[model samples]
Target: MPGSSLALLISPRHKVIHHDGREVPDPTKNKAVMKELGKWWALLKDKRFFLLVPVMVGFNWNGTYLGIYLTRYFSVRARALGALSSGVAATAANIVWGYVYDIKAISRPTLAKSTWVIFSVIMLTLFSW
Candidate 1:
């Protein structure tokens, strides 16, 4: 805040909108309602949320466990290179997925679920081998 030319604080006089699309009468109410949404989305809106949420849970859990496996299976140098390659591949995959979803108008949930299944199969095959 010391080096900023403009004032860092919001004045209490300003009006803002609540996340739920209601008007906050003054700046004082803004801080309380600035969150993305006041309530969680009903899963009924899109059936996909139910599936994607579990996939996300599994991804987080498996990813943490994967670090231990990687360290145990590979040499220090191999592990480092694997990490680098994985990062690059992940970035590339993200870009491709984004482009395909946006430009191609693909169904996001179907794509996500199918990809997860395909990857899981590949993982199981590799682990078994």
Candidate 2:
């Protein structure tokens, strides 16, 4: 449900009619629709489009856990620094992975499987420490 809010943010509205078919959207509404369409169009043109959502989800999940671990296992100052460092690391990793996906045309399944393997390895290492 992490990305579920996207539906609310970008969902299209539909009109229902009794007898006749639904009328076309108002010009004002069409403007908003066109703007949203343009944004999507731009995204599609970008090479990194395929990686955006997955990287976002991965970063969010890892970031939340990193913050929690820092709070529980370290001093307040250390936790703060850890959080900052983790944020930078996650951002960099996301960008690199995105580039890899774009340049290599990696499939989603392969990306997902690799993500799990990497996450598991990281988790095991962190837990052992």
Candidate 3:
């Protein structure tokens, strides 16, 4: 996989040491499918995971609809442009949101709630229109 290859190229193969003189074990050292599945199950049991399901579904539904609309209604050139623009816009949004989420001025919970409110307002506006 590209991700594994990139990790191999970039990550240190030896033990990781923190500035506070603590040694951290490499996460990639041990590989167990059953253990991974157990961790996945634990995550699935979390209330946050259940809450995130609908949000993910809505985002995926909109993305699929947008893709279908572009392919069905636009010419090849137009569709290509649309796809490129969509990718660029998504990338830009991710970068902007990453910085916004990392702001030290606001509390994490406050930031999370504000983001949810903004998301809900946007969704409502789009769907209502």
List TM-score per model, in order.
Answer: 0.51, 0.38, 0.78
lDDT of 1 by residue, 1-129 (tens): 576745656444335555687754654545744352443444346676564565566667667777898988889998889889989999999998777667545677777767778766755664556
Q: Considering only N, C-alpha and C atoms within 3 Å, which residue pairs clash in candidate 3? A: none
In lDDT terms, how accurate is model 1?
A: 0.68
Residue-wise C-alpha lDDT for candidate 3, range 13-114, written one tens digit per residue: 355667698766767778888999999999999987775665677678778888898888899999889889989999999999999988999999999878
Q: Over the stretch 12-123, how does candidate 2's per-residue lDDT look in tens digits? A: 5454343577655654645677889999999899975664555556657766877787778899888878768877987999899788767656787788778767765665
Tell me how candidate 2 scores on lDDT.
0.71
Residue ranges of candidate 3 with Cα displaced over 4 Å:
1-24
Model 1 clashes, total count: 0
lDDT of each: 0.68, 0.71, 0.81
* CA deviation > 4 Å runs, candidate 1: 1-29, 33-37, 41-48, 104-129
Clashing pairs in 2: none
lDDT at 22 for candidate 1?
70
Relative to the true structure, candidate 1 reaches a TM of 0.51
Q: Which stretches of candidate 2 lie over 4 Å from their true place?
A: 1-69, 105-112, 120-129
**In TM-score terms, which candidate is top?**
3
